[model samples]
Target chain A: MFPKMDALGMAGAVPRAPQQERSRVTRARLLEATVECLVEQGWSGTTTTLVATRAGVSRGAQLHHYPTKAALVMAAVAHLADRRATEIRAEAQALPTGPDRLDRVVDMLAAAFTGPLFVAALEVWVAARTDAELRGALVPLEARVGREMHRLTAELLGADERRPGVREAVQATLDLLRGLGVANLLTDDSARRATLLAAWKQQLKGIVNS
Target chain B: MFPKMDALGMAGAVPRAPQQERSRVTRARLLEATVECLVEQGWSGTTTTLVATRAGVSRGAQLHHYPTKAALVMAAVAHLADRRATEIRAEAQALPTGPDRLDRVVDMLAAAFTGPLFVAALEVWVAARTDAELRGALVPLEARVGREMHRLTAELLGADERRPGVREAVQATLDLLRGLGVANLLTDDSARRATLLAAWKQQLKGIVNS
Candidate 1:
């Protein structure tokens, strides 16, 4: 029923508050659905329709929020990066100081690979390689992750960014972890993953001590 | 017109040897063209028609050799791995044993990232993430590369697989290199690249000396 009312009654008549909350909830649902689709179909097959259907919303509503599939994908990527940054910061902080720090960093880094979010990130990366627009959008996220990684490793090693071999080792370690992510995804071997992680920590320790 | 000839003369008339040589040349040309296509258009965009046109061969002839696009991409990836193996072996042998080994390894590893072959391989890797067939074909190649890296690092560090920390560090360094490749492909900062390489070597030194 529609109503004509005075000031206090008119304020209640406005549905803006509930509408805003519903919009926020729908947006979050869509983003989460996008991640699930990425994990299932990768970047190549993650259509907007799939994301909308997964989110239990109509295609029109999905488009109303995201405008385009690229925008949706970009938003999903940012959501993932924010989540990962929090995990990394928390894990890095939990590590014991001195020699034990190396073990903690290695464990945390290795743990990052076992989740679906990282897999989605890899899909985004592959998508970015060919899409200039996606690449442009991804640069800030990549830089932020890289800077965080450098900071985390430096803190763990008790070395500054300028310390000899710190940057190189950090970069190399990130590469190895990325490669391992691909490897772990392709195969079903946990032992090999463990071996790789252990070998990485040893190398990191060597770098820090040297 | 058909020519009537004796059996011995007919055998000579076939020109089998020259035809085989020509086929080999055509195959090589096709592979070179495939690499070019991959570098220009990425794995998803590269097609048999495009590769045939780039190689200046008929589409029929290209298919006669490669049979499928997957076969062509696999061939390109294999050729890349072989070339990298040769370079790594040569670089490793050229370096004097001990601390000098790390420098030589970095130089060779650097070459792997700065070239067309690595770029092509990166495309193959991206393609493999979604295509089960491509992933199946790439597993052995990835394993071979990993083994080669392991062997080279073991030699450089004078550590065996039994030393878990040494192996872990080596693997982590490799991950960093892989991550750096992604970064380098996306960015144009040479100074940052240099810093990454320097840090890698310093990390290696620490691992080796320890």
Candidate 2:
């Protein structure tokens, strides 16, 4: 049940502005709660009603923003992923311009994949496998997120894709980190991951450097 | 709703031997059907009744072998994964032991991950994220499967783990392939995969060849 917009609201008067702001706040709450639910309960367990309860909003208000579970979860993940991607880019700004910059960049990227946002996005990804509607929404969102990560990784590492193996090497790094993220989904693979990362950084330096 | 075994069958006589064989056959059918269901329907959409119907077995027969959905699907994936892992090892025997060995090994391992067995296992994997009981059953199964692949890869690459970066290099290869498989689930990523594989094989050669 949507809130009724009065005659002045219909005419776009300034007095109805607070209603618009309240609606934005409510929508943000729903999206944030959706990501939390996805991370905590997984896609199958997360429901619109539960999200509404978690967000402390009325079920009607939640439905007004996200009519279906698919739309709600997709939008929630996309919104959160964009924020996380931006955070990754922002975090890269402080990195040292030294020989270890690739190492730091790899560490930063690995941290992004192992965090709650990746977990939440992973839930949607698995669900989307059988749900074409979710897949339709997820594919483009993931492409944008993935491309942003790739470009940012290249920027932080200062690698020239014009070099022979540079592009694929960067991709392998992302793929490896993603795989490490998947490994961590089941258990803490940090010990083995540490060894692998150390080894990979040495190898990546060779390909990314010249 | 199990089939009633008569006194002759209860005695475990030679005449009742077909009962044992028939039970094995029925189990194979159910397991095969479960994998098919998982690949086609994903974890959430798959149900025991549906698997039974697909297998052309009575619900009683299916439940007799697997008392719960978790048990059924987990058993299905584990059984198939074992077979597939064996197949990967067997297929390796035909590979030429030459300069291209590493390339073929990576391709073989990547193929294993992109197949229906991996897809089915992936469904259980994601479902297990939310279901503790399923995770309890899956973690050990996956550990065993993962170790097998790792050992096989080490053998195929002839890498001595005593050397620095050798063990981690093998793992990185598996992780990279798994990540590539994840990328392929939603769409065809063969082109990018080919490129990444090319770059990684060259790197792998350096680590594996001592």
Candidate 3:
């Protein structure tokens, strides 16, 4: 990205827009690699060195992009949240209008909860609780993520705008999915997941019908 | 606990059953301290030195009881699980056989999910996922806890044991509650919790009636 002087040594300094684009691509690759490491190795093992190696970039290039580990990890999470928001938006747009919409929404939401992104985020969230610097950076980002998630969930559910608790219930749905995701970390337990999904579907059907 | 001697302290030279009582008390105190440490300061800040100080025991005495940090944390979690089992049994015994029972049970379960014990256990669970030594010790203990938890949840719900999916749905209730608990870690959103509770109560009522 930076003329490849660091690692990967491709060429010298390039032009403005193209250089920036390459930089963006490199940054995205590093962040994606960070998430992969978090999911596979958890917090303790997700080192900057590991991330650089995973990203297929030189250590110097990684350092040039992210000056610190906390910065790299935080940026990675924010990057992930943004990507998820875009995915949700696209999914919501393409979703068919029908009785089965809620089921599809739940499936999408469940996938969002139980995957590598969620695991990576969970690792950061837990670590940041005790780390003052990390917490300071994460608090605002998590708030933004929460708001977007709540809004998307509300949209997917077609929840009543006039209802006082509809939004809160949507938030609860996300919270419940998060809990199920946490449970899945230890074991896949599909029967438990299916039962939970059925119960969630039943309650949502009640809400929609009401 | 061995008499503060021998780092590899594996010998019958310690003492008899009389020693057992004192050792039990020391071990219990250490475990209690560990939970406190976990709740107050997550995994990273919880050190053996700090735990030994908090438990009002000598470092050597702590080492004598549990040789390693992994062992200490695992034992603390197992101890908490056992204590929770006892509490659940007592709660089950005192529970009334009436229409309000499910409501009361939900309240009790909610308290269980959002408390110091659950937080302590969650810290261990998250840490264990990354730590091989910790995970090896934790898996079996977590299985035992899961069994006890499932058993108690079934008792509280008065779920029919013969129904395959019903019991799993009950487990889902617990999982959802746990997710709510995790959300509460960042913000105490009582309104959302209440809405979820109401929804869950309605669903449970439907189940009971059916």
RMSD of each: 9.2, 7.8, 7.4
Model 2: docking quality category: medium
lDDT of 1 by residue, B1-210 (tens): 567743212212444587886786688778888888887787778999999999888989998999899899888777656656665776577678766777777767766765677778777776776789989988887787778766775665566646536666666556656666666676664677676677667756765566
| Model 3 C-alpha lDDT per residue in residues B1-210, reported as the tens digit of each score | 755632212234545587775787788899999999998899877999999999999999999988787888988988887777667667877988888888888878888888888888888878887787887788878888888888888877788857645764677678888898877665565676876787677667666546
lDDT of each: 0.72, 0.85, 0.81
TM-scores of the candidates are 0.79, 0.90, 0.84
Runs of candidate 3 exceeding 4 Å displacement? A1-16, A58-61, A91-96, B1-17, B88-99, B161-165
After superposition, the stretches of candidate 2 with alpha carbons farther than 4 Å from their true spots are A1-20, B1-17
Q: Candidate 3, residues A1-210: lDDT per residue as tens digits?
A: 344543222245455597887797799899999999998888878899999999998899999999888999999999888888777778777989889888888889998898889999989988886678888898888888888888778877888746754654576678789998888777676676877787677766676547
Best by TM-score: 2
Q: Is candidate 2 or candidate 3 better by TM-score?
A: 2
Candidate 1 residues lying further than 4 Å off, grouped into runs, are A1-16, A88-102, A152-172, A202-210, B1-16, B87-101, B148-170, B206-210
DockQ of 2: 0.60
